[model samples]
Every structure is written in structure tokens, then in C-alpha cells.
Target: MKKALALVIAVLMVLSIVACASPASSNTASNSDSGTPANNAPAAATSSDSENITLHFTWWGGDARNAATYEAINAYMAKHPNITIIGEPVSWDSYYEKMLTQLSGGTAADIIQADYKWASDIVLQGMPFLNMKDGPIDYSAWAEMPAEYAGNKDYVMGLATGINVKALWYNKEFFEKFNLTPSDDWSWKTILEAGEAVNKADPNSHLLWANSDNLNAFMQSYILQLTGKHMIDTENYKITCSVEELTEYFNYVKALFDTGTLPPIEDLVVYEGLAYASQVPEWLNGQWGMCMTYASNTLQVLNDSTFEIGTMLYPVMEGATDTGISMMPTQLLCVNKASPYQKEALDFVEWFLKDEEAITISGLQRGIPANTEAAKLLEQNGVTNAIINESIAVAAKHAGSAEGPFDTNAELNAAALDYIYQVAYGVLTPEKAASQTIDAMNAILATLK
Candidate 1:
């Protein structure tokens, strides 16, 4: 009887174990079913079709400027649902260093906006350089550029972003006060004399403009005017000039500094680039008569100024070697070989070069639209911003003869500009400065090649 009881208990225990195992097996099956959807996966992302794509974009600008860019990019995203752009912006002070690191680290943006000064280095560093003819890069559409800028069948590093034409920015209030007229016929000689007259008339005020650094942009303009040459030429890989020409340029700068027409070096050091950016609050508020800058940027300083401003080309040097002004590529756009979405980037850039949307969004910050149709669109929009329109007009008139393929290594360009400043400050003689520049530039060029 006891053995029969034990056998019945064992059978009951086995039944209980079976019940537990059933539930556990069912739970495992349910979990596997839950993961089936994940294993099936979703579609890959791409530029076209239903695929999604993301592009990294970067630029340098102020807060207001960055906000405007954000708005533009947001609008672009709304139009193109599949494409997302990530913004990586920095202040101008940190822009170059940051970009260099990004590129060198092999994580550059898909489409980079480049300055002509840095294009050669970017290309030489093995970033899948593009020619104008790549896929849809339409250099022909860019009106501000010369026909020659068309991407060579070889390695074209960048596309024209905009044409930068330098011009004289005068305070309307001071011009009227001094009875000086803004004219195309005004020459460098006229500017010097007028500066002296304006300063003499108002001993407390400065008649001429000043920048913060030793390299005088003012000096470059006059030197270019006198010599019909540029300090750096990337196309032929030449630095054109003799020590004599540089010495004369430096002497001219010294005269301006000594004359009481322009600000002293010390004062200028405290007020660098304020003439363009109005960054120095005190100097901006102080009495300054005229400033020199690109036509596209003249309005930036005056937009909030209490005084009226006027724009015209810098005075041509009388009997100057070159009849035209020194113009440079203010900005450029290039496709990154490292970009995963090269085709999409090219298409977007093509649109930017040719589309109306790009013109409206850019607001011609870098310069006038290089595209012919884009320029017309800007005009049709009744934007009628004089600075941009004037820049466009100047570019249309004389971009071809503007000396440069200014593609010297960015470091060389910086070095050359630095030397120019040193000479202006009387820190070095023109001969020493010129020799140093040539040697440094040659070293840079050799490495680039």
C-alpha cells in the first residue's frame, strides 16, 4: 500500500514539471517572434528615391549670420525630406584651424565652402578634387567668374562661391562735411590727398581708414594699383614683384601713418577690422571718415550706423601699370571626396550655383552670385541691395583680368600678408620682407607640388 502511494506522488511531480516546461518554452517562442521585425530590417538611405541622406556642413560667421544660415538650411531640408544637413559652425577666429583639423582627420563636410586662398592645399591633401565639369558643376552659369575658371578636365579643387570686388566705403556724413565727392575717376593719389585734407579740416578726426594688423590691406590695394601685380598668384605659381616696388608700397604706407591722416599703428592694433566689422565699439563710435572694403560688405558696417554710407571703387593709381582693380575670389564651394554623398553634394552645389533659392539664402555675404540666372533672380526679387548689385556690376565688368589663381598654400598667403604688415610697421625693410616671403612661399609651394 505504501509503495503504491509513493508511485502516485512521483507521477504527480512529473506532471507539475511538464506544466512548468510548457510555459517556459512558450515564453521563449514569444520572445523570438518579437525580434523578427528587427531582423527583417528597413531600407538603406540614399540621395534619390525613398532613401534618407545626411550631409555635414560647416561655415564661419557671427550669431546673426549663423541664424540666417540655419534658416536657409532648414528651409532646404523642408523641401528635400530625404536629405538632412548637420551644421558645424564656428566663429571666424577659429574657423581655419577647425577646418584644417577636420580635413586632416578625414572627416570633412560633404560640401565645403572654401576661400581661394586655401583651395590648393585642400586639393593637394588628396580630397577627391573636382573639375567644373564634374557631374553637374556649372561654372558657365557663374557670371562673376571668368570663362577660364571652368573646371579643368584635370583636378578642379573648388567651385566659385562668389566674386569679391574691393571698393571704397565712405561715411556720407563725413564726405558732405569735407565736400569730397565719391567718383570712379578718383585715383590713389586723390585718396591720399583727400585724406590729408579731411584730417586737416577736422584735427580730431581721421580721414583715412585703418585695420588692426601690420599687413595693410590699404597698402596692397595701392601697390596692386601701382604695379598692376598681385602678391600671390596660384595659377602660374608665381609671386610677382621686386624689392623696389615693395619698398615704394611700404613708403606710401609710412607716409599715410606719418601724415596724421591715418591712425597710428598702436591705435590701429586696438581697432583691427573694425572698419569692416564694426567690432571695436569705441573706434566705431569715434570720428573716422572713410573705410575700404569689399562692395558686398559695405552695408554690414553701415546697416546699424547712425550715419549714411556710400560706396565706390578705390582710387585708381594715376598712370598705374594696371587699369583694373585687384579682385579675388571672396568664397568658393567644393565637393569633398571623403563625403559619402558625393552625388547629392554635387547636385546641391549645382543648384546653388544656378538656383534662385541659393541667391536669396546667401544674401550675397561672400560676394555677388557667380551664376548669371541667380543674379537675375536676385534682381527680380527686388532685393535691390546696392552693395550686392554694385559688386555684381563690377564683377561683370572685369573679373577676367583680376590677377590670381591665388591658390598659394594658405600658410604662405598668411606669411606673405604678415610680412607686408611687418614692413608697414617698420619692423623689417622691404628687401628683407620680400626675400623672406619668396623663400617661405617657395618652400610651401614645393611641398604642395
Candidate 2:
């Protein structure tokens, strides 16, 4: 009985060996037939069997942007039946906080829409976003600003969709009523003088509409123009200007308030904390003659006004070393490094940025196209508006260095606004405000390091 059991075990061992050896040979033959190496055979087979893919794309914008993006996505899906794009659209107000949370949790969408200011924190600082330089996206047709912004380093972290610059928008009727035309000279003295004349003509109408955020943008530009340096030294992660330089900026702002070039702080209190002056009744009703706004926002401002609107280049300071007009990317598209569908995400982004059909459908919702060919195609289709073209021309002629990501540092921005308001409301002198602002900004910069 023992001898029979041993013989049976030996036979069973031989059969087990043959079973393993046969599958190995069969897999090798299968790989050869499929034109894949043994090492990649499993992955190749899986890809062939399941070619369908879904990609998640997220962005923050208004209803118009959402609708346009959705149409483009649907069109792409129609052309490529194997791909499905899931869009997560939200308002600009809640976008950053939500996206940051999602990023930390590793749940961000496959494709992400990032702001130019978010690049330092989200891309260059070792964030897990894919390096787009290795991808198939084309950059040859893009303008200098967009191309540089998209690929600032060894890796390309973002693909710019549009280019924008800080610009001034004025209500034409208000200017005409005050016997003032938007100045072609575009100097600080000229704007202030114009504002004084407008306010004098109609005490009820203010020369400019500004919220805290608006003031911050103006201050950044002013400081850059005066000092020929960025608000923050991106290389060293420090405040770029001295306390004396900051004092000069604060004093200039105070002078605007004191000379009635800008509306009284009390008058603007209701809109103090807002980022945009769009909802202010004075702006919508045309009581505010002018506003510092983005080039992309000119159309919306015009639509909101009952009167015709005009655009102006951002004013340069006297003896200014720089233009102070910071041309920046309005929208940037990126792919998550950890996403399972990286290839699909890159494919979609390339198509969206370079395809003629996609550009035609996108129109100017995000501002002027960053791709030179797309811009030409958009113009050929008659989708280019005069205001947008003018804005682009002005930026091309006068814009200086683009603002660094640290220029929009939230903590520093808020502190600067607080000090500015304090100076406006007489709680702090310009000298004190400047001192405080420098200290506060330096503290914030230290934390970043």
C-alpha cells in the first residue's frame, strides 16, 4: 500500500509541473501573436480588451464658461466614441478651497484648471501633477507669455488656455458727460487728474470703483512700476520692496483718497471685502466712471453697463521703470500625476487647446486664445470682438514682466488691503501703514520658506 501511494504522489508532482510549464509557453505564444513583449503582455492585453476610458475635468467659472466647456466636451466625445469626459464646474468663489482639499486627499480630477498664482504652490513645490513636457501637446503656436508660463522649468506643469492683463475700463457716457476722454497717454498723473475732473463735474459720480481686491491689484502694479521689481522676490521668497518703497505706494493711495480721485472709504464700505466691483450699484448704474479690471472682464463690464464702455492701458507712474501691466494666463489646464487615465487626459487637453473646432466653439469666454493659430481661426470665424482685440494690442505693446505667483499671496494680500483701508479711513497714516505692511508681508514670506 505504501509503494502505491508514493507512485501516485510522484505522478501528481509531474502533472503539476506540466500544468505550470504549459501556461508559460502558451502566454509566450499569445504575447508573440499580440505583438507585445513578455514583460508588457498583461498590460497590452488589458488595454486592447478595454479601450474605453473616462476622464474627469474640473474648472471654476460662470454659467457662460460652463456651457461653452460642456459643448466642447460633448463635441469631443462625439468625435471619439471610446472616451467620456466628466466635467465638474463650480463658481470661482468656492473653487480654490475645494480644489486644495481635493488635492490633499488625492481625489482631484484627472484634469485640473489652475490659476497662474497657484503654480508655485501646486506645481513647482513637488506637487504630484504630471510633467506635461513629455506629453504630445503642441506649444509652437502659443504666444511668449503663455508658453513661458506653461513651461517655466524643466517640466511643463500647465497649459495656458488664454492670456490676460490688468487693464482699466471706463464708461464712455460718464467720460463724455464730464468732457473727458479716456486718456491715450495712460499715466498716473493723467488718471488722477481725469478722476478729479470727473468727480468735480458730478459729486454723486465717483471717478473709479474699487474694492479691496481692486486696490490690491493697483498697488501691486504701482509698486512694480515704481521699483521695477515684483511685489515679492520669487527667487529668494522675500518681499521685493523696502519699507520706504511701500510707504511711497501707501502715500500715493492715500493721496488718491485725499484728493478725491477715488471714492471715500465710507462710500465703498459696502463692497469693501469683495474681489470684484461688478455687483456694486455704482458700477452697474454707471455712477462709477471707471474701474481697474482684467482685460477678459471688459465684455462683462460692458454688458452690465447701460452705456457704451471703453478700455485703457494700465497707467504708468511718472519716471516709471516698468509698464506695471502684468500680463498673465487667465486659464491653465493640467493633468494629475496619480490619475489612472493620464494618457486620455493629455489627449483631451491637446485637442482642446489645438483643435480648430474646439477653438471655434470656445470663442472668447476665457479671453483671447493663447494659441496663435487658434486666435487667427477665431478671428476668421468672426468670433473676435473689438474690445478683446484692443486689449490684446495694448498688452502686447506695454505689458511688463508677468506677476509672480507670490504676488497674490493671500495672507500678504489681505494684510495690504487691511492697511490700505486703515489709511483710507484715517486709522493709520501712510507711513505707519507702509511699515506695518512690510512687516506683515515679511512674516508671511518667512512662513512660505
Candidate 3:
């Protein structure tokens, strides 16, 4: 239950877990790759029916999510006075690094919350989460789930809380104030033009607010549109995109920085690993125009805000290699394989995912609920945000690929993001950063499995 603050604590955790054989194939690891559930889920029982126990649940979020979570957990506890649930909420920037420490030290929460990339990375490294078949998680409600957001059934990692899709979210007031007409069809080129106009009109306001994670996503989306491929071919264990392609990507990133399309690296670096763009003063004050990151984060970023927000599908050129938008699991509720209270942990997870009361209290905080019935109930209750639904709809329409755990390996992601800052700060030329990134990534990929 102790929090580890060290950033460098455990990329090395994989050294111990790398022995796990991947249940999915080298191709895009969809549910079809998950051949079968190793075993069926245990019959469900309410936590109220079980013995008195204390469980810890941890996740990264801002005030809105953190608040809703506690309310839901408290409601559950009220029903089952014997069970005490502790909520440990941390900022997104610090969440995973802290988890790396806890996971390595065998002190992770009983019920842990994981980003899809983190879940994918965990499954790719090893089945470190308690598989559904090994726990009392009810599977009946997740039947209509797509192969994309569904965890590897072959490995049977824990299920998604909801779906997450990235989009270009903007401040409607900011755009109008700048006399800009932003449209869903705008391309990267149009974005640059709009940014230039905003910069010219108000020297104090910038066009976009993107932390390192957002920058990485935008770069990937761009390259996917250009190359119809991801940064790394996890299936082949290679950086399949050529060095030249990587250079173009980096150059595009550089241009975004230099031309005021994105805030300068120096200004944005303070928020490098922070979860929300709202953490940036310029963004929080409405001095920035857009945030192109996870739409699931909309509510968190709108904390104490005064402006209207808008959504557009992430930009793609008219004729591109791929649309490159992905609809993925917002986060996974996984029980720690090492936790002694895993049975109890899965107990909370099932209630969180399936219980109508729990879903109502936590409606859309995580994204659209993965449970079909839960989704319908949320809609019926008018709990869905109009802005977030806009993003989910547009993103789903344009989704062009499935994400594999390999493509999002945590270590490989770190390597790529590290070079992104170097490119942004002019510490390395685009060509140099690109080649070094490929070489560095390939070296890490070689060691992953």
C-alpha cells in the first residue's frame, strides 16, 4: 500500500516477467487470437455475502473521476459493512511508474486499474493479472464486446471498464475568438494554418496543448496515416517503418513545435508526463485552442472550466494509407496475480462492471461501459457526456486498425517518447533522432520476449 515515487524504479520488472509465453499470435492480437478461455469464470457472489475484508483500489485520474470512484466504492461498502475499500488515487503522470515499483516489489493494489496499453504490455510480458477463468468475474455481460477492446481470452486478462478513443478536442470559444473555423475534416495542414492565425492574433495564446503522451499519439496518428503502419511491428519484433519515414514524422513534430501549432517544448515540458492538458496553465486558462488526446479524459480536463469544448475525429489527409483512429479499452480492472486477496479483488471488479447501481454511480467516468447493459442504462439515465459521445462516434467511424500489446510495450513506448522530447527541444536533428529511435527501439523489442 506504500506509494513509490521513483521514476526509474522498474522498467526492469520485465526482466523477471519476460518468461511468460504470449498466448496471442504475432499478428494484430485481437480476441480471435485469444483461441479460448483457459477456463470459465467462477460463479458470482456479492461482496456482501463474503467474509469481512479490506481491499485497496488504485487508479490515475483527476477530481471528477476520483470523486465518482470513491462514491461508488463507498456505496458498495455501505451495502457490505464488513468490507472496507481504500481508494488510492494518483496523477496519471506518476501512476504507471509507481505501479512499476509496486508490481516489482509485490505490493500492487488488490484491484488495480490499468490503461489498455499497460494491460497489453502486462499480457505481452506475462499474464500477471488474475485471469477471469481463475476468479469469480462474471462474463455473461461482456458477450457483445468487440475483439479489439476485449482482452486476450487466450491469456484471459481482466476485462475493459469501457472503450477509449482519441480525438481532436478543441475549445469552441477559443476558436471563434480567433475567428477560426475548425472543422472535423481539417487535416494536419489546416491545423497548422489555424494555429498560425491564432498565434498571429493573440501572441499570448497557443493553438494546442499536448503533453508528451499527446505528442506521441499525434505523431503515431500522423505516421499511421502516411505509412498505414505503427511505429513498431511488434509481430515482427522490428521497427518496420524505415528511418526515412521516422525522420518525416519527427520533422512534422518539430514543425508543430517551431511554428506555434503546438506549444514550444520548453513551455510544455513542465507537463511532460502529467495526465491532463488542464494541468498546463495556458490550457486551464483557455489560452490554448485544442487538446488532441484521449476523449475519455474530457471531464477531468474540464475541472472548474468556463469554455465550451468541441470534438473532431483525429486528422487524416484526404488520401492516406490508413485512417489510423482506434477504438480501444479505456482501462482494465485487473486483479493483481500476486495479491493474496485476488478473489476479493475480482469480487469488487465484477460489481464495478456489472452491478446496475455501481454503473449508475460511476457512469462514463471511465468511458462508455464495456457492459452492453451498463452502456444502455447510462444512456437511459442521461449520464453520457455529449462531447465524449461525439468523439466516440467519430472515432469509431474512422477506426482503421487494432492495437496489439507488442506495439504498445511500455519499455518501447518510453524509448520513443524520450526521443520525442529531444526532437522538440532541438537537441537532435529529425534524421538523427529517427535513426537512433529505430535502433534503440529494435534493441528493446529484441529483449522484450
lDDT, candidate 3, 1-449, per-residue tens: 23353433454566446634442212112223133223344323323555676777899766778998999999989987888898989777668788867666555676788877765566655566666653356667653434434356556566788877878888888988988776778898888788877887877788888776676676677777778777667667887788898898898888887778777677788777676666667776888878787877777766545777788878887688678777777887877665544556677888889898999889878888877789899999888788778888887777787655555566777889989889988899999999999999899988875
Could you give candidate 1's per-residue lDDT for residues 1-449 as a string of tens digits?
Answer: 99999999999999999887662321122222222222112112234546787776776655655776677678778888888877767666757667777555555676777655554455455434344443345466555443323232355567766666766667777788888888767776677788788777877677666664224445455556667776655555665666677667766666676665676667766666453635545336657777666664544675656766777765567776654454456666776554555667676777656666766886656555666576677668765567656654654454325534343344665766777667658898767876776777767766654
What local lDDT score does residue 388 receive in model 2, on the 0 to 100 scale?
A: 68
List candidate 1 stretches off by more than 4 Å. Answer: 1-48, 127-129, 147-154, 212-223, 229-239, 273-277, 324-329, 356-367, 391-400, 406-409, 413-449
lDDT of 3 at 203: 73
Candidate number achieving the greatest TM-score relative to the actual structure:
2
TM-score of each: 0.77, 0.85, 0.83
lDDT for 366 (candidate 2): 81
- Clashing residue pairs, candidate 1? 132-151, 142-370, 143-370, 212-272, 214-421, 215-421
Which runs in model 2 stand beyond 4 Å of their true positions?
1-50, 146-151, 273-276
State the lDDT at 112 in candidate 3: 82
Q: Give the distance in Å from residue 5's predicted Cα in candidate 3 to where it truly belongs.
A: 41
C-alpha positional error of residue 241 in candidate 1 after TM-score superposition, expressed in Å: 2.5
Ranking by lDDT: 2, 3, 1
- Candidate 3's C-alpha runs over 4 A off are 1-50, 133-136, 143-153
Taking all chains together, the TM-score of candidate 1 against the true structure is 0.77
Better of 1 and 3 by TM-score: 3
